[model samples]
Target: MKFERLPFIMKNLIRYQATMKENDWNKGFDLLRSIEFQEGVYKTGPMFFSMEPAENEPRYRNFEFFMPVNFQVEGE
Candidate 1:
């Protein structure tokens, strides 16, 4: 799902948590994902781009990112 540009504090927290063990990192990530999910899935925010656009349209373009609901089994 699309996420708003995380605030500096939140970003720092996430980065710090990511440095932990694998299971711990997963737990933190899962918690963040759940919070985002509960807040309504879709969001629109600024993202950085390095390429020069042919026309001026805010350096970033609006993007629609979504999270898959569930995993599918083979031959479901």
Candidate 2:
């Protein structure tokens, strides 16, 4: 694939992960679940998320998100 052809792709899914915790384990779990992943339904626009598996730690919970973004070219 040619590098210049990269821009032709309009959007792509970007994977994201975060291990968050306030103080306790329950709080962290609640916080992670409380996130409103609207999937671009309201005003945020369309979003594509990845459902990859993740390992949980002792205290904090792991969160994964795949957001849609426009293609970008380096040093364009």
Best by TM-score: 2
Local error of candidate 1 at 12, Å? 13
How accurate locally is residue 28 in candidate 1, as Cα lDDT from 0 to 100? Answer: 43
lDDT of 1 at 3: 86
Clashes of each: 0, 1
lDDT of 1 by residue, 1-76 (tens): 9888865421211111222322232454455456445644432332221222223454433222222323211210
Error of 2 at 55 (Å): 6.2
- 34: Cα error in model 2, Å: 21
How well does candidate 2 score on lDDT at residue 62? 58
Clash list (residue pairs), candidate 1: none
Model 2 bad stretches (over 4 Å): 1-11, 22-59, 72-76
lDDT of each: 0.32, 0.39
